[model samples]
Target: MTRVALMVAVMAVAAQIAIPLPFSPIPFTLQVLGVVLAGFLLGPRYGATAMVVYLLVGAVGVPVFANFRGGFDELVGPSGGYLLSYPFAALLAGLAAGAAANSPRGRALAVSFGWGCAALAVIYALGATQLAVVTQLPASVAVAQGVLPFVVFDLVKIGLAAAVATAAAPAIASSRA
Candidate 1:
C-alpha cells in the first residue's frame, strides 16, 4: 500500500519534468520512467493498480499530470491516450518482470528489454491513435509527432527502470519477508 502510494507520488513528481515540443501537443515527461519502474518493481497487479490510482487522483482535479495540469479533461484531452495507456504498459512490463524474477540475471535483463519494447509499443499505438483522433491529424503525422521524438529517450528510460528494478529486487524481496 505504501509502495503503491509512493508510485503515485513518484508519477506526480515525474510529470512536472515536462518538455513541451513545438510540433506536438504532447510533452516529453519522466512520467514514463515512473510507469516503467512501478511495473518492474511492483509486478503486474500492484503496478496496474498504482497507475489506476494515479489516474483517478488526476481525474479528480489533482494537478498530477504534465505541467501541473489535471482533471477529467486531461484524461479525455488530446494527450489522453498516452495517459490512458500507462496502466496497460505497466501491466505488460510487470508481467514480464514477474515471470523472469527467478531467472538468471542475463535472461532477466533480456526479458526486461523485450517486454519493455512491447510496453512502449502499446503506449505508442494508443497514444498515436488518440492524438490523431483528438487533433484531427493523419495517422502518419500523429505517429511522427507523438512517437518519433520520444523513442530514444523512452528506450533510455526503460533501461534505467529495468536496471534499477533488477538491482533493488533482492532488497525489495528481503524486505517483504
Candidate 2:
C-alpha cells in the first residue's frame, strides 16, 4: 500500500511536465501511462487507491497534474470528469489483468495490454461525454477532438507498460519465494 502510494505520488509529479499541443486543451502527458502501469503492477485495489490519491493530491493544489496546474477548480473544470474517472479506469484495468494472471494460458503482457486498452477506452468515454456536455459540442466532434488524437500514443504506452509488467512479474514472484 505504501509502495503504491509512493509510486502514485512520483507519477503525479512526473505528469506535471507537459508537452503543450498546438490546438488541443489536452496536452501530451505521462499520466495515462503511469495509470496503466499502476494497474498492471499493483493489482486492482492498490491501483485504484493510487489513482485516487493522485486525484486527491491534485485537488488539494499540489500542482502535480498535467500542465503543472492543479487545484479544486481544475477538478470541477472541463477536464475534471476525465481526471475523476481515472481511478475507475485503473481499477478496471487491474481487475482484468489480475483475472487473466490466474489463467494457465494467460500471458501477463497480453493481459495487461488488453486491460490497458480497455482502461483507455473508459477514460475516453467519460472524457468525451463530459466534453460534449460542457462544451455543447456534438458527440462526434468531442470524440474526434478528445479521443482520436490520443489512441496511437495510448496504445504505445499500453504496450510498453505490459512489457514491463510481464518482465517484472516473474522476478516479483521469485522474490517472494
Q: Which candidate is the best by TM-score?
A: 1
For candidate 2, lDDT tens digit of each residue in 1-177?
A: 676877678677658766876755667787778887787777778888999988888989988788878899877766777787789888987875556667455565677778889999888898878877777889998888778888898899889888887777776557546
Q: What are the lDDT figures for the candidates, one per model? A: 0.91, 0.79
- Candidate 1: segments with Cα more than 4 A from true spot: none
What TM-score fits each model?
A: 0.96, 0.90
Best model number under lDDT: 1
After superposition of all CA atoms, the RMSD between model 1 and the true structure is: 1.0
Residue 50 alpha-carbon offset, candidate 1, angstroms: 0.5
lDDT of 1: 0.91
Q: Which pairs of residues collide in candidate 2?
A: none
- Give the per-residue lDDT of model 1 (tens digit) for 1-177: 999999999999999999999999999999889998888988888999999999999999999999999899998889999999999999998987676686887787777867888888998999999999999999999999999999999999998888888788788778867
Candidate 2 root-mean-square deviation in Å = 1.9
